[model samples]
Target: MKLTVVGGGSTYTPELIDGFARLRDTLPVEELVLVDPATERLELVGGLARRILARQDHPARVVTTADLDAGVADADAVLLQLRVGGQAARNEDETWPLECGCVGQETTGAGGLAKALRTVPVVLDIAERVRRANPDAWIIDFTNPVGIVTRALLKAGHRAVGLCNVAIGFQRRFAGLLGVDPSEVHLDHVGLNHLTWETGVRLGGPEGEDVLPKLLAEHGGPLAETLHLPRAVLDRLGVVPSYYLRYYYAHDEVVRELRTKPSRAAEVAQMERELLRMYADPALDEKPELLARRGGAYYSEAAVDLAAGLLGGGGSTYQVVNTYNNGTLPFLPDDAVVEVQAAVGPQGASPLPVRPVDPLYAGLIANVTAYEDLALDAALRGGRERVFRALLAHPLIGQFEYAETLTDRLIAHNREHLAWA
Candidate 1:
């Protein structure tokens, strides 16, 4: 099987390719294709792939090209990590609207919606190419507005999975903080990609049943120490969620509670700074900068690592991913693409549809759908007015009267930018 990675030019390209290289010995796929509009990064990624497979004498060929078709043709799996418009464009998405107190972010607030508008077309175009070349290959996406893009692919009737390092990574971290062995922890998680919850955590030992309940009553426990969140979700769920989930839940809750909206740039910048600095300290003396860089605050799925577990390692592996709901949660409506637990094996993935989320969790899920729908709308139609209204519905938007004021300002403020279509 030939595997292809789109946006092979990303900074994370080397790690992802190397991560998958380990899988060459096990999985059926043999060829590697690295595709990117940027020829140089594509070559660099392909070169790295060649180097990794050098000793194995594998059939792998790290072909690099600008032609979209060559990248996806005859592939068994395709991974997309596109930064569609690049950082400069994303920065504009953040800074332009903040002038009016209505911050725009790439995947959450109006800013994210704007970026979605620009990205959706490009993603769809790539998917269409994959459809003609490798119809059955699973499209593993690592793009912002993951839910929005995954939904679009489903709407077009393509097979794919939205993978995020955030959900599973958080589950294991929470387990570690809770002092339970990672092998024994079973997580029942739900919500959108960045926004999710560990609704349940059951340890393996006989005392495991009571561990979650006790943590709930205690309000804050040792497990809470690992979380960097706004509401203490596990505290609210009666347990602690992964520290990464804190990113979305904090934003989700602030919009729910105080009704004040903070700028998304401030959120990303603050967290990025903290994470970057944390890894930058003394660890540098031992490992080379490249390996340290990924461990250090860079969000990556270690796609190859996950592939190993899901392929045939024997232990049950499951993760909540951005995929069409397919009625897993009865109340969610199959159309809503939610991240939920799914069992994986060699044949492929089978999402577990247990029951509807509680009314409270349902409410949170609904809020995410609203935003995702708006992003899809803006993305496909390029309607700035839709973006403005989406902002008006945001939990963060209604909290402040200035939101409508800012909306009007944004309409006028971004007249040209909004009128691009």
Candidate 2:
């Protein structure tokens, strides 16, 4: 099996290689191509893979290339980890948007659409290359705004899968909170990437309404106390939510309990800075096993293995992933791809086709989905109008004037970054 990483220059590349290498004992893919625009960065990952090979019982030859086509051609599996605007630009992307009172979260809402606007062109270019070079290769995209980006890929007619590690980490958190082994928890979650909810989680068996609420009562614990979300949402809404759900509701109610702008803005900004520091610190790299540890922290093995298996053998595996919505939910627009588990394989991804959600909450979420759609439209079509729509329609942005002001400021602030369509 030939496996390639399109953006092997990323900080996460080593850990991803570690993922493939660790799975080598089980899945046994033969060749790995580390491709990046920067030769030096690709070499860095190649060196790490080589070191792992030197230590291993079986060492696969690792190739580093600056050429994307060379790396992707004739490959069986491809993992994309590219940062199109780079981390610095991403920081600006969030900050500028937040100054507009746009909530400024990555890979969700209008921010996600803005991210896709600049990124989709590049990603679609890669997809084109994959089509020309290795038509059969399954592209496992790890890019942000996964659902939105994947929609572009699908619109372009490529074989790819959208993946987010949020589900894996949350499931493990549920495991820890519930006092059950992580492996023992049967789970189901659905919604767009980042902002999703655990529809159901049970100890053993599936398909009982009684089982669902009981599991939440036991397993939804304080997002393991690190995140203010799952706990806060559970406390108020009577249900645990995906971690990023905090951005959806009023921040004042969740953590600092402040409803106004400046204070909430300050608190949110501090949160971003704090999180970015954890990632940007070079000293942390000296720890040797941070990526490997983090990969485990997310419980990525199940999802990773599922894709590898699907590619190799074509057995159907159920997994929650971001993809184009072709009527997966009864009321959700056919164009909006909400995240949900599905039976997947060589043909492509298909949504599991869940029933219409309960009336009270689903309508509210559909409104959120509308914002996501506007986000996608704004990014892909590249207009001030769609941007205004996304902000104006957002669940968080609230009032009309605030949304318009935000739209104006964010568009002006990120002008150089935006497509200017």
Candidate 3:
């Protein structure tokens, strides 16, 4: 099968290439196209991709190009991993929000809104191009603000599914702690993208016995430590929250921590420089160890599984993905995109029925879903008022003063990207 990666020039591409090479039995990729506007970075990443595949004896042909249409043309599946404004814009997204005394994150709060606005339009344009090229192709979005971007693609009637490494990362961790294979640990993962909880950890299948309590009873400390949350909180909540939840559960503390550290964007920029230098080494045939510190751990596995399932190849039957809720959460609108465990196939993903959500998590999910609605509006029809309203609606920046300030800063820092601004 043919596959295309729109942001194949990203430092993260080598990790993905490694996965495609190793998991050839799962996805069986033939032609692999790397599409990027940054020609220099694309060549560097492309060369490493080819070497990695060849080293593994995988026969996928690696092609690199700046033309989006040509790169995606007739592809079986197209993965979107592009950053509309690169790390510099991300630095602004992570920095300016902290000035409002709010959590500075790329996927939630004011910063997430900025990313959604900048990303949605670009993703939609690419989706349209892919649609024109191959109407049957599935669009797998690995971009940040995935819920908003995936919503944009689906609303525009594109065949798409959103993938995140969070669920797979959790599964792998839980499996290691439980002394079982990752596939045997099924997470009752639910909620919106980046804002989710592992309500249960079942073994064998979705209907398998729930071992979450056992996990918490034995491994709560390490789990909580990974989430950067106190063990007491996990015991009290009785569910493992994603690390991103730390931003919400400890907003002020997170903001304080963020203020003291360099933006994640800055750190990643430095890592990318080193990674590029490494990627340029002709002898480097594998993803560098330093790339592990660059994040998106297990992203390759998740992408492979999702793409395989979507294309009717051998893949995990059930996986966590972001797709239309379709009433999986009674509290959320059916059209709202939610991240949950779903049975994936050629027909697409259908989220499993979830037990009644506790009011604690349901309330927050509902609140963020509303914020995402406004974020998408501002992204689709940009205006100062729309941007301000979206920021005002976010649970993290609910105050008008903070919202107004963040809105102006967002537009100011991103004026070149926002067509209406």
Candidate 4:
């Protein structure tokens, strides 16, 4: 088995490499390629990846390349984790939207739309190159604005599946709380990427008894605190919202908080500098402790599971993934890419039928899905009107005045990345 990582220079690569080392039995990788345009960072990361494999005594060979086609040629799977513009650009994404009184984030709201515009095209081009080299290869996208990027890939007729660590992160957290194996806990995770709710937590499988109420009854306060939501809200909703929902539930408060603190991108940029320095060290054979704080918690496990299920032919095994709705949610269009529990196999992922959704969650999901549609349109078609329409559609930026201001900010901050700007 061969796997390619498109943005191997990212500080997150070590976490992925650590997973590849530990979960080699599951993925059974023979040749691993690290593809990146940043030669210096790639060399450091590649050296560390080799050291990681060597430390584990894994037989898989680590190769680094700046050539996308050569790196992906004949690969079994290609994982997309590239940031079109580095952290400096991300800092801009996270700061500009705040000027419009919207929560500036990399994967939601106006900033998210900006990222989608920049990311979708680059990811699609990479997908096209991967298809040209190996038509059968599966594309596992871990890019920001995953819903849009995955939808773009799927729409372009690529064999792609979107992977996010949110479900796995929740599973591990709930398992720790329940004193059970992570795999033994299954979540009724619903909604689109970065916008979801855990309506039910079951044991063993989808049909297992629901323990979500029990968890809330016992650990509601801690759970709510972790999500930065009020405990009363969780008790009232009888569900756990992903942390991203905080942007919606407390938009103004979050914008105020963001105004006071440094952008997440700035913090990450500092972390990357330290991590790259560590990666350049010959003695560092394992993933550094600092990498854990860099985030993408459990990303490697999620990627391994998806890749193993796809390449290893693990059929009908359920995993939470981002894929076509295909009527999984009766309220959503079939082509809408949603994040939910799905059975994984050689055929790719197909979401399981979702139980009926409460109007509270359904209303928001529908709203965001519509915004995503416009976001994708702007990402692909590229126009100020589309950007304005998407911002207007976004629940967090619904005012026409806010939309207009954000559209200009989005274009100005991203002129170099946007073709039609």
Candidate 5:
């Protein structure tokens, strides 16, 4: 199979290459294309990818190209990981929201909406090109604000499924805590992407015993620490919220903490500098340990499992993916995309039915679903009023004054990328 990565120049590529090499038997990619507009980083990252594959004796030929059309042509699957304006833009996304007294984050607040507005059109254009090049191909999106982007792609009728590592990361952590293989842990991961909780953690299979209460009873303190949430909150909710929830649950405190530290974008930008320098070393044939610190733990495994399952190679894997709700959560519109555990195969992913949701979580999910509707509108149609409305709808920035201020900042920071502006 031929697989193409759109942002192949990313520092994260080696981690992916490492997975493709180690898990070669699962997906068996014959050709790998690294597509990026930046030539220097592309060569460095692509060269390292080749080295990683060669070290593992994998036969997948690595191709590097600045041409998106050429890179994706006739490919079996295309992975979207491109950043619209790079980390400099992300730095802006993380900082400017603080000017409005909101938590500064990449995927959850005013910041995430800015990213969506800048990213959706570009992704749609790329999806169109991918469609023309290979209609049979599946597009696996690993972009930020995934629920919104996946919704846009599905709305436009593209064959797409969004992937995130949140569930896999939790699975790995739980497996370690339980002294079992990661595959043996199945998460009742539900809600929208990034805004999800682990309501249950079943062992062995979907029908296996629910050990969530047991896991929490013993590991609550450590688990809460991992999520940066209070143990009391976890005990009260009887669920574990994704780390992104910290931005919502402790917005003001997080804002204060964010004010003290340098922006996360700045830290990543520095890390990229070091990672590129490492990639330039001809002796480096394996993924650098530093890459682990770059985040997105277990992303490669998630990608491989999803691709293999969707292509009919890997049989019947239950994975967490962002796809249409299809009434899995009756409260959400069937067309709305949700992140949950599903049975994945050649036919595509179908979310397993969810147990009755508590009103506490269901209410928030419904509110965010409504905000996402408006957010997609602002992202696609592009008006100041639409942007303001979307911002106003966000639970984190519900007040009119903050929404108005953030809307202006978002537009001002991303004017070059936003055609309507």
Candidate 6:
């Protein structure tokens, strides 16, 4: 099967390449295309990708190109991992929101809205071209603001599923702590992308015995530490919240912390520079250890599993993915995209039934879903008013003054990317 990675130039590509090399038997990739507008980074990543595959004795032909249409043409699947405005824009996304005393994050609050606005249109255009190239091809989005982007793709009628490393990362972590293989550990992961909770940790399958309480009872300290939350919070909730939730559970504290530290974008930019230098080494045949610090932990594994499942290859029958709710959560609209454990196959993902959500989480999920609706609207039909409204709707930036200021800062920093601006 053929596969295409639209942002193959990204520093994250090597991790993905490593997975494709190791999991060849699962996905059985024949041709792999790396599509990117940045020719220099593309070549560096592409060379490393080839060397990694060759060292592993994988026979997939690796191709690199700047032409999106040509790169995706006739591919069996296309994976979207592009950052529309690069790290510089991300720096702005992460910095400007802090000025409003809000969490400065790439996929939450004002920063997330900015990312959604800049990303959705570009992703849509790529999806449209991919649709034209191979109507049967599946689109796997690993881009930030995945819920909004995936919603755009699906609403436009593209064959798509959204993948995030959060669930897989949690699976691997829980397995390590439980002294079991990752596959044997199943997470009752639910909620929207980047805003999810592990309600239960089952062993064997979806119906397997729930061992979440056991995990919390024994491993709550480390788990809470990883999430940057207090152990008491986990014990109180009886569920492990994704690290991203720290932004919500401790908004003011997070904003204060963000203000003191350098933006994640800046740190990543420095890391990418070092990573690119490393990628250029002809002797480097494996993904560098530094890439792990660059984030997207276990992204390669998640991508491989999702792609394999979507293409009807050997893959996990149930995985956490972002897809239409379709009433999986009675509180969310049917069309709203949510991240949850689902049965995945060539027919697409069907979310498994979820237990009744506690009002604590359900209220937040519903609030964010509404904000995402406005974010998508501003992304699709850009306007100052739309941007302001979306910002105001966000739980993190509900005040009009902050929303107004953030809207201007977002548009000002991103005017070149926003056509309407």
After superposition on all C-alphas, the RMSD of every candidate to the true structure, in Å, is: 5.8, 4.7, 0.7, 1.0, 0.8, 0.7
- Candidate 3: stretches off by over 4 Å: none
- For 101-152, candidate 3 gives per-residue lDDT tens digits of 9888888898899999999999998999998999999999999999999999
* Displacement of the residue 136 alpha carbon in candidate 5, Å: 0.8
Query: Scored by CA lDDT, what does every candidate get?
Result: 0.61, 0.65, 0.94, 0.93, 0.93, 0.94
lDDT over C-alpha atoms for residue 6 of model 4: 99
TM-scores for all candidates? 0.77, 0.82, 0.99, 0.99, 0.99, 0.99
- Model 3: per-residue Cα lDDT at residue 322: 97
Worst 10 contiguous positions by lDDT, candidate 2: 255-264
What is candidate 1's lDDT per residue for 201-288, written digit by digit as tens? Answer: 6677222463556545554654565465533555556644545344345654433332245444455445434433433343222222
Expressed as tens digits, the lDDT of each residue in 268-350 for candidate 6 is 99999999999999999999899999999999989999999999999899999999999999988999999999999999999
Superposition error at 187 for model 5 (Å): 0.7
Tens digits of per-residue lDDT for model 5, 157-179: 98899999999999999999999
Query: What lDDT score is found at residue 181 in candidate 3?
Result: 93
- TM-score quality measure for candidate 5: 0.99
lDDT of 4 by residue, 3-107 (tens): 999999889998999998998878889999999999999999999999999999999999999999899999999999999898988899899998878898999
| Model 1 alpha-carbon miss at residue 283, Å | 20
lDDT of 2 by residue, 248-276 (tens): 66543532332234433344445434433
TM-score-wise, the better of 1 and 3 is 3
Candidate 3 global lDDT: 0.94
Off by over 4 Å in 2: 177-183, 203-215, 219-221, 230-232, 252-287, 292-303, 314-316, 353-356, 412-421
Root-mean-square deviation of Cα positions for candidate 1 versus the true structure, in angstroms: 5.8
